[model samples]
Target: MSIHRLIVKSAALLTAGIAIGALLAGAAAAQQKLSFLAAEYSAKTLPFWEQVVADFEAANPDIDVTLEVVGWNTIHDLTAQRIAAGTMPDLVNTATIWVPEWVDAAAIRPLGDDLVDATLRADFVPALFDKGAVYNGENWGLPIAAAARAILLNKGLLAQAGFDPDAPIATWDDYRSIIVGVKEKTGAFGYAFDAKGVRAFRDFGYYLLNNGGTFFAADGRAAFNSPEGVEALQFLVDLVKAGAVPDPLGTTLEDYQPMYEAGRVATMINGNFAIAGIKANAPGLEIAVAAVPVKTAGQTPVTWGVTDTLVIGKAAPVEASRKFIAHIFSTAVRNQFDEAEGMLPVLLSQAGNPAFTGDPNIKAFIDMLPTSQFDPFHPQYAQMQELVKTAMQSAITGAASPKDALDKAAADFNALVK
Candidate 1:
């Protein structure tokens, strides 16, 4: 009853403890963990994703999800660092234009029937899903958010400029007259011209596309130096020279957004998401939403439709990641995310949801979807965009004429494509 019994009991307890520890470790190893790198859409973005992660974890106890939200400006660099470090996230949200590069690098996996079933693929808005998420004839991603550009007019400034606050600007001539009138009468910038950074190409695109110009021709050659492109660039340059916009050489959309919200800018071209920002920042400011006026009457209105995509990394735990992707792409989740971020829904099922249909600002963007054109999703398109930005800055600063600047850009773009 003394030494022998004590030693046996001690050994038995030690064996039990080890067995329990091994079982616990195995259980922990059985749970799948996934990492998500989301590009920040707004202040609400992180919080919304946090809630989604919480809900997903609660519903799927066997899967663990971690969310990291980075600003749009830094996501690309951060993602590249993660890839180089061999620690890529299971899922990532990136600008749709960047998909081609990621595909070219083989950094992401294609979402085939195994990941995205036919039913799920069919639910996405065709224009967005087909054009934005497809690369090299494969579905590479899903559109996380979509937006279409439109013009926002300050009604008070329009009235001050002796134009009907509710009148539609039907042609470029009418729009130009209002731009000059607003500056002359109110001494406020008539149009907010963003001529710096990546967005400069977007600004130029509005004019170029509306004027029947395109980034590439039918043969996939650079066509931005065509007469239509030159005319559009000249229009913007002329506006800059006439004092219709402020500091076109130095300003960007981020700089002008606040000025517009403060009612110091008369008009600006912005995505439908701007309505939410304007409402939040300047609740009392009266605003009017209008189509970007055509180059001439009857030319048909065009808008830029942009989408940010959600992709799965090649190194991801495919089963767990696919389950999560399907969960988020469901109609209810998609609607909530789009509403919170003030983005147009990428899901066709959510297009007619009351939350979107009830808002005129959202309706306007939806209406423009028919005539919307997206950026070229080429591997070198980012470089081409930078070249275009350089030309825009040169033209705006009077360092070169619009035609000359664009001609040089076109040459560089052709070389890049070749």
Candidate 2:
């Protein structure tokens, strides 16, 4: 070869070698490191989570995932705080109510409309994916677990009241009569609610919806303080006055747990988590779960349905994070993870799978899903909770009429949004 040709060939070889080395280095650098934040209950189901995570990592050997266990009470605040501090995990599990807030803050990254598969999205119930995941016209998170406010009754207690425990409690009037009969005959309070805790507000939300009242308007204005809301609040107050529930002045969610376990309360209107707690505390007791009864005949039954979503943090690598999220919702993982935690699975396929259907009691949550009321997809959710909490405490404590209290709460909530 001529000297010039030799020189040109040598240079080309050097350039190709450099390009190959750079490609290898870039590939290595693309290996992702991710962490997920979840509650202790889910942490206890770590083995199931591990199987799911291991499958994902095995499929994508370049990724490493770490699970961080968060305490339930602080997870919401912790998620927001870390995101605000610019130290958010790659993925975090949070309540549905937090989705809109995080989306507004730009703390959560969307799946990008192009990446969301139409078939997969269609597999999700429209009402759920639309109302539960979408906020301000954006999808913020994917649901993993579902929760709903339902009535948990002691089957033995109802039988003692001369009613079949397996029979559905269809109306508030029927439930009330049974409660009074149980109270009169057995000398036990027939119902128990978190009369003093933030949960007190949830009952009003559930019952108001049960009575055909909307909790919030499409514009996010308070709509629950209407006649239905007032009537629901009065019913709760009456339960307290009639000695069906413990003193409204001195009851918390924690208080009701033990009371129900000890058989002091014949029925409880609480979240699905109560199932696990009840089983742990009173293993031998016969218990049944039912949807919140309708307020009057011909009214469609409704309940407070809640969910926790897994959101990819804005700081996460988009493509890899999306894959991990998709894996988490895979049929095998969602079925095992949700049932292990005593929660409803978000995947439509697993929603009523035989594995979850073993317990007939849990059917109430599944049955109510079509009509359940979701918390408003408001960006000001945390603030709205505060407003509702204050009004609820005031009404439950008898410091203000339910109408005045809820009306003021609505005003305050609207003001915060404005």
Can you give the TM-score per candidate against the true fold? 0.93, 0.86
The per-prediction tally of clashing pairs is 0, 0
lDDT for each candidate structure: 0.86, 0.77
- Angstrom error at residue 18, model 2: 19
Off by over 4 Å in 1: 1-21, 218-221
**Cα-based RMSD of the predictions, in order?**
2.5, 6.4
Worst ten in a row by lDDT for model 1: 215-224
Off by over 4 Å in 2: 1-30, 113-122
Global Cα lDDT for candidate 2: 0.77
The collision pairs in model 2 are none
